[model samples]
Every structure is written in structure tokens, then in C-alpha cells.
Target: MRWPAKLPAGTLNRSIMSAMDVFPTLAEAAGVEIDSPFELNGRSLWKALRDGKREPRKDWLMFASETPIRGHFNVTAFNDEWKLVQEIDQGLLGADVRTHLFQIEPDPNEHNNVAAAHPDVVEEIGEAIHRWRMLYPVSGTRHELVPPPGWRAPKDWAGYPVAVGDLQDEPAPGMPPPFALPTLDWQHGEAGRLIYDCEPYAFLGGGLCK
Candidate 1:
């Protein structure tokens, strides 16, 4: 909500809105024209806000990592009732991939993995993700997923910190299995450079690297 003189002031609708909505929404509110051939992925919330409706403005919203195809692909789609998290190349290390489901209302903490109990819901949400990806495919990257040795977090929350000492081997909840550098079998060279063979059908640089 903005405090500007032109904007409305009220408790607006409860909705799962995407960050993508900001561009078009702000444009319309400011009486600016955005001429385009492509259909936008987001809708403006101005109508619901102007009418003072408390209903949801959108049915669902999507969240994903920028380089989903590059490495540790993480994508999530959620509605008012449920959420689905799909992880690929888990931990940005190797090929452990899977999906987990959660009931948003009851499991506020998102601790319990109800996927086993609610296969139908899992299938439904998974289809939604599939459709969305088909419409707007995930992007790619040239750099390797994991960084070289001696790489440290640039910011406070950057790199994943491994547990040490007594708790070193314990698995962190909701996180994929810890990455063992040895498991990757990366061939190390001078100046800390590392290399690995791409899979036979591995997709990279907008095509198969092999």
C-alpha cells in the first residue's frame, strides 16, 4: 500500500500476487500505456483494490530461482490452500531431485511432508508447474552450479554453511542430502580449477554440450 495522494487507502484483497504484477499494475495506475503483442504473465490488482474486495485477486503465484536450469533448480507454486516445492539437481551438486507438498493452512511451519498422504494434490500441483514451465521455459547459465574450493559467501546469507563437529553428519530438515565434494569426482588442476565430464545427453548453452 502506498501513501501517495493519488493512490487508494484501504485493506485490499487477500491474494497470491506475483512480483511480475508490479510493472503492469504500476503502469495502469499511473495512466501509462504499455503497447505490446505479448500477453503479460501478471494482472493488475487495481480493480479489486478500488472495489475494496477482500477476495483473492489471483488463484496462484509462482516463485523460482533465477537459474533453475543451471544447477539447483527450485520452483514453487502455491495457492491459498496448498504449496508445492520441486527441487532439481538437489543442493546444486548432483541428480537427487524430488517434490514435496504442504497444506498451507494447517501446516504453517511447512515441516511435515504430506506428499505421501496426498498424492492427488501432488499430481494436481505438479501439473500446474508443468503447464507454467511449458508456457515460460526456465532460463540457462554457462557457469557451473557449485563454485570452486575456497569460495566464501559474498553476503551474510550467500553460501550454504555445513554443520561441523558433533552434528556434522546430521541432515538438515527440508534440505537435500549434504554434498560430498569427493562424490562429484571433480578432477582438480592448478590454481584450484576443476573439471567434470558432461552426461551423454546433458543440455547446456541452449543445446547439448556433447
Candidate 2:
């Protein structure tokens, strides 16, 4: 398959390729030839891509990464002197989640005239959303919600909004200053989900997944 064009920045680098090579090697190192296509979950590979790491292509199935720490954060809690020590235990998860949205866009050529094209793309995107909802059925229901001190919500809790914003743009009204969802490789995952769901002719390989 042609790789997704909109793959995250570090996805194709040599370091990632090398890391990918390790999966098969490790199996050999352990004297076990896992003859099947090396199957890994999508999230794991994506994490490797984000971290400038890679893994051998196994027969990967679509699933989220198990890692608890996958993304970036700012230590704003430290600003309150009394909370400085307490803040050490707090940090965000899934920095990769932040980049999930920018990967897809309405075709520029169809810009004001996308009404004809929007229907199919919208349906496809909606199905992806549904699958994600089915896969992860929990929620925190906010743009940001602070956890009790020394605690954090499940990583997938706040992820849906990010996912939705990535697939479709919907602005909340009367919500202080305007906010834009931080753009990332949203389409890659979205398209991958479509492929997983057996959407016919779905283009999983392109600038979006590469």
C-alpha cells in the first residue's frame, strides 16, 4: 500500500525504521521465529513514529497503544508555590493525541463548492467516529478537566473531543475566547479506522497515513 502522505513528521526517519526492525530481531534473539506477519496495534506503531522510534511491521491490528505516557504537557501546576511539590505527580498523557486533527481537510479545489463531495466524506468520517465511540465508551466531557490532586483521568477519557475535532470542525459558542483544536495526524487514524471497518475503497494509504 502507498503510505499515507500526512503521516506524522518522524514516521519515515531512519531511526524509526531501525526500531521497527527490532521486533523481528527480538523474536529471533529469543529463538522464536514468529512466522506470522508481526502483528502490532496501530497505537504502538504510531507512538514509535512520534517518539522517533520504529518497530518491525508485524501483522498489526487496529488498537490503541497501551503506554500511559504518549504525549506532551506543560507544568503549569508548579506556578502555585504550595502546589509545586504536588505537581510532580501530575502530567498530561498522549501528546500524539494533540496532532490527530490536521491530517484531513476538505479538498481545496472543492472549497466553496464541496456540498457534492461533503456527503461521502462526512459519512465516512462519521463511521470512523462511531467505531471510536464503540471502542472507547468512557468520557470526561470537556476541553480540559482537572483531576483530583495526585490523580489523573484515564488517557482515553478526554480523547474523544480531540478525535471529533480532528475529523470535523464544530465550534462551541459563547465559550470565552475562540479556540482551535491543535492540529495533528487526525486523518491517519480516522482513515485507518475506516479501513478497519471494511469501508470499501477507503484510502488508508496516502499522505494521511504515511
- TM-score winner among the candidates? 1
Root-mean-square deviation of Cα positions for candidate 2 versus the true structure, in angstroms: 22.6
Q: By summed lDDT, which 10 consecutive residues of candidate 1 come out lowest?
A: 187-196
Error of 2 at 172 (Å): 28
Q: Model 1 over residues 1-210: C-alpha lDDT tens digits?
A: 674565466565675567878788788877888899998878786665556665453455776665412345678888778889988663324557588999988997999889999999989888888788776655432333444432333223343342222222433333223363232223222222122333323223121213
Worst 10 residues of 2 by lDDT: 77-86
lDDT of 2 by residue, 87-112 (tens): 11223441221211111133323224
Residue-level lDDT for 103 in candidate 2: 16
Q: For model 2, what is the alpha-carbon lDDT of residue 108?
A: 20
| Collision count for each candidate, in order | 0, 27
Residue 138 displacement (Å), model 1: 4.2
Which residue pairs come into collision in candidate 1? none
Best by lDDT: 1
